[model samples]
Target: MSDNWVVQNLQDILNRWNSTLSDIWTLITMSPENFQGGAIWRIVLNIHGALQAIGYSLLVLFFLVGVVKTCGTFVEMKRPEQVFRIFIRFAIAKGVITYGMELMLALLSIVQGVISTIMNSAGFGTPQDTVLPQEIIDAVEDCGFVESIPLWAITMIGGLLVTVLCFIMIFSVYGRFFRLYMYTAIAPIPLSSFAGSPTQSVGISFLKSYAAVCLEGAIIVLACVIFSVFASSPPTVNPDAAAATMVWNYIAELAFNMLILVGTVKMADRVVKEMMGL
Candidate 1:
């Protein structure tokens, strides 16, 4: 044959994997748009606005509750430190109310900057391509029709596995996007608790959890980069083995590496939580 059929099959698998990985990268680094024409983002923005409207009312209630909890007598409210602390709390809470969207966006920006820095430092402008070895090509081309039958079966199965892993990896990144939208939409309610000294802990925890979610992107990107390095150095294939055995070995190792990447991407949230002690 003019072209090794195994090599041609591997190329198609490589293309699909590359396309999915590119989508993952795009999801990680690009800034999300809230005001864009897309209905999903706009709906998220509208929900955020609605929650913020409700947040103002909740802020007043939280502040009053804080006053009651902190002050046994009106005299305590008159003390310089107590009065100043309450004032500071209200001011911070008000700031959050007015700037919640900007604050959420800022957190996303910082995490994305970290992702960009990591990718740049690694000298990876794009996800690394996992190519089949030249020896595999040579070996497969030497196989007779009967031997190539099993080789073709192995290749087909490997291609399916790779395609599935690629989609799994991409979908994991999409889940992150959904979380981002969720956080933005509901930020005001948790943030409003800052108006009350007693309830400030709720706001603090919310911010920490949100920040942790944002940082998951960074962790996920790092995982992909590490996996790319592993992909670049695939397990050595023994050319002396029967063609089908050699193909199966290569496919098995490739799938294993892709599985590792997919697993890491799925665990991105847990990894971030452990790193941040959240």
Candidate 2:
């Protein structure tokens, strides 16, 4: 906090941005069981349990359908080898529906390993915080009362934009977490489709979508890591210029970097889907 309104305004914006960035990093790395103390996850588990009963009923129906469709004749079904193959399919499908939550969590664990590898290789223990340049502060402090007017206007607009971007970035991360919960809660219905060969595509697609959701975190982490490295070297400013011009230049450059990072986080799901060919 500074006595000068211009410095204080910019400081507030940077503080908000740094806080938001830190939250984003923490959210992407946390498991559903650890997120928000797992309260939401407990509700999700209860929902999954309730759905599992319905999944079992549907599982029986699908198993019957598979038996009827795959066995054109009673003689075919009576054959020992045919019976064994059909039995195996039914058993495997039942196992999938029963353990789908675990399966999904396992998938998530694998993707988290990828994120960890990325962070370790890049050697970023934490995100870099953006700082106001000393030159800009000195220049603003030295300004006459009349000359400070333009700088005041510049800081106001820049600070507002920075604040807006911070929320957008954080909301994107929150949206990802909600999707994870949604997928876990509704998993049983689609998982029941695995019992029938003709309907197995539904289960396959569901798994792929869940995987894409899990992998989205990796994309977000990579974007933030790159942005952190870029932030290490602050935006270049002209010390010889007027205080207003220098502040405007710094704010514009910093905002652009933030925009790119936020944009990447928002598009993380799309990126994962494209990679998955979904």
Clash totals for all candidate models: 0, 0
- Clash list (residue pairs), candidate 2: none
- The lDDT, on a scale of 0 to 1, for candidate 2 is 0.89
Writing each residue's lDDT as its tens digit, candidate 1 over 193-246 gives: 999989999998888888988998888889889988988885788867877787
lDDT of each: 0.85, 0.89
Best by TM-score: 2
Clashes counted in candidate 2 amount to 0
Per-residue alpha-carbon lDDT of candidate 2 for residues 60-84, written as tens digits (9 for 90 to 100)? 8988888888888899988999989
Candidate 1 stretches with Cα past 4 Å from truth are: 1-4, 34-39
**What's the distance in Å from true for residue 105, model 1?**
1.0
